[model samples]
Structure formats: structure tokens, C-alpha cells
Target: MDATTLALLIGAGLVGGACNAVAGGGTFFTFPALLAAGVPPVAANATSAISIWPGHATSLFGYREELRRHAGRLKSAAPAFVLGSLIGAWLLSVTGNGLFRQLIPWLLLAATVLFAIGPRLRSWIAPTGSGTLPKPVIFLIDLLVAIYGGYFGAGLGILLMAVLTLIGLSDVNEANAVKNALATIVSSLAVAVFIVTGIIAWGPGAAVLAGAVAGGYLGARFARWINPRILRAIIIAVGLGLSWIYF
Candidate 1:
């Protein structure tokens, strides 16, 4: 890759990792950069998933206590989550770059909207008084969320958080814990699929991976001084700008 493309990919990954570490929505940066660097749309999606996913790991570790408490749910939800991810990843692979390219603008827009409305969606969907949802519903929700997570994963956290809250996990931390785990599963499985299919762009992916790691570390270390609201605004603006350009 040319120096400019390398710079773009690394810069996007850095900003994206920081955005995710501070607020969320790292895909808002990396996906657009991948496309600009001439990665095919479907390939870019897979690369983005792997590149941005490391940032979510810290959040998962931070919520291990909550994860332990919800261990039972993970057992029941695993089958559906894994299956959905497989199907979604296969779907994207089959979609090829052409159809996925057409869908990129819309998908990004949807992700932005979902991210923007996450809190409101949680309040609207989740009853104030409720316990963990029934297994059947949990599996169904997990299935759906996993599919989307494997598909693109842009705002999967918000979607997972909303579903977790709606299913009656009252503690925000608890819900986030579950969301992060399932999201990890989804992305992990998707990465496996992408790797097997040889669609992941190694050069860009490596650039993004290195940048994201550094950015995540920096963002977390300095999180106390960072204004998440500003990061959130930056993500929103970038997402909207990419959508406008792509459309």
C-alpha cells in the first residue's frame, strides 16, 4: 500500500480505538478509511470487525463480575449466538463486494441511528421492574443480535445493551457485560469465517490492529480527563459525513 493509504488506515484506527475506548462507535472511522484505501466493501467490513474488536476486550474484562453472575444465560444463548454469527458471516461473504457496497451507506446510517438512540431505546423497550428474561426470548434476541453483530458490528453494543436491558437486566454494568461477551463471540466467529475465506485485508488489518491497540490503551489510561460527549459527537459527525459521501 502507498504511504497515504497506510497513514489513512492507521489514523482511522487510532481515532476509532479512542472513540470506542472513551464512548463507542469505532467503526465510524475504520470502515470509511478501509473503503477509501480501496478495500472492497465486504472485505472492509470483515477487516473493520477484527481491527476495532480489540477495543471491546478491555470493557469485557472490566465487567467480569457481571459476566460471572450471568453465566447460565451464556450457556443457553451460546448455540443461537454462534449459529447466528456463522450465518451472518456467511451471508456477508456471499453478498460479495457489489451488493454490500450498495448497502454500506444504509448500514452505516442505521448504525449511527442506533448508537444515537441507544439510551432512549433502552428506556422505551425495557420495563422498569423486571428480572432476566425467559430463556426462549433471550435466545431469540441473542440470535438476532448475533447475526447483526457478525454482519457489521458497528452499533452492536447499543443493540445488545438495549436487548439486555429490555430482557430485564437492570444494572447497566450487567447489561454491558453480557453485551460485550456476546459481541466478542459474534466478532470472533465472524473473523474466523473471514479468515477462512481469505477476504480479510492483512495489510490494512495489521495497520488498524496496531493503531487500535495503542489508541485503546491511551484512551483508557486518560479516560478521566476525556469528555465522552465530545468523542460521541465526533463519531456522529464522522458517521454522517461518510454516509453523505458514500450516498
Candidate 2:
């Protein structure tokens, strides 16, 4: 990679990581940066997943208590999540670049919409005093979310959070805890497939990874000072702009 490409990738990663920590929607930055850096569409998607994987791990660690409290739900959710993720990852490995390119704009727009409406969707879909969804229905919904996460994953957290809310997690922190844990599982399984399929662009992925680690640390230290709503608005704007550009 040229110096310019390297710089772009690292810069995007840094911004993406900070956005993720402060709000959520890091992929809106990192995925576009990879595409602009000249990575092929499928490879860029896979590389972006790899680049953001570590952040999920750290987020999961921060939610250890919530995870423990929801241990039964987590246990029940794991099998479906793993299966869906593997299937989605394998599908990506087989997809041609041309096809993936054609799909990119739509996928981005959908993710953006999902991110934008996430909080409202959670409230509307899982209103207070609503009964919990049946186990099978929850499994099906989670499986679909896992598949999407494995495939592109820009708004995976929002989707996961919505699901957690649907399943009776009214507490924001508790929902976030399960969301982070499930996201880690989705990314880990998808990344393993991407690695085995040799689809990742390691050089650029490494750049993003290093920058994300640094940015995550920085974002954490300054999180209390940051207005998350402002950060979230910025991410929503970026996602909309990128979606329009790709379209």
C-alpha cells in the first residue's frame, strides 16, 4: 500500500474506534475507508470486520456482570447465533466482487436506517409492559440478526440491542451487555471464516486494528466528557452521506 492509503486506513480506524466507543457506527467510517483505499468490495467488508473485532472483545469485558446475570439467555442464544454466523460468513466467501459491489449501497442504506431508528424501534417494538416473545420467535429473530452481522455488520449492535430489548431487557446496561457479547460471537465466527477463506487484506486490516486499539483507549478515557447524542448524530449524518455516495 502507498503511504497515503496507509494513512487513510489508520485515520479511519481511529475515528471509527472513537465513534464506536462514544456512540456506535464505526463501520460507517472504516468500511468506506477500505473501499476508498482500493480494497475489493468483499475483501474490504471482511477486512473491516477484522479491524473492528478487538473493540467488541473489550466491550464484552466491560459487560461481564450483565452477561453473568443473563447467563441462561446467553446459553440458549449461542447455538443459533453460531450457526447463523457461519452460514452468513460462508455466503460472503462465495459471493463475487461484482455482486457484492452491487449490494453495497443497499446494505449500507439499510444499516444506516437501522442505526438511525434503533432507539425508537426498540421502544416501539418492545414497549413497556409488553410480554416476552416466545423462545422460537426470539431464536429466529436472533438468527437473522446474526446472519446480517456476519455478512456486513455496520449496524449489528443496534440490531442486537433491539433484540435484547424485545426479549425483556428493559435496563439499558443489561441490553447493551447482551448485545456486546452476542456481537463478539458473531464477529469471531465471521472472522474465522474470512481468515480461512483468505479474504482479508491483512496490511490495511492491521493499520485499522492498531489505530482502533489506540482510539478505543482514548475514547474510554474521555467518554465522560463527550456528549454521546452529538456523536451519534454525527455518525448518522456520515452514514447517510456514505449511503448516498455509494448509491
Indicate which candidate wins on TM-score. 2
| lDDT (tens digit, per residue) of candidate 1 on 1-247 | 9998888888998887766555455777898899898888888889998897786665455556778999987777789989999988988888866676687678667666655565566566544634445678778878887888788766565556556646666454455457667777888899899899888988899988878877765655554454546544654665666567667
Q: Residue 30 in model 1: shift from native, Å?
A: 0.8
- TM-scores, all candidates, are 0.77, 0.82
Give the range where candidate 2 is weakest over 10 consecutive residues by summed lDDT: 217-226
Top candidate (lDDT): 2
What are the lDDT scores of the predictions, listed in order? 0.72, 0.75
Off by over 4 Å in 2: 108-130, 217-245
Give the RMSD in angstroms, all C-alphas superposed, for model 2: 3.1
Cα miss at 230, model 2 (Å)?
A: 6.9
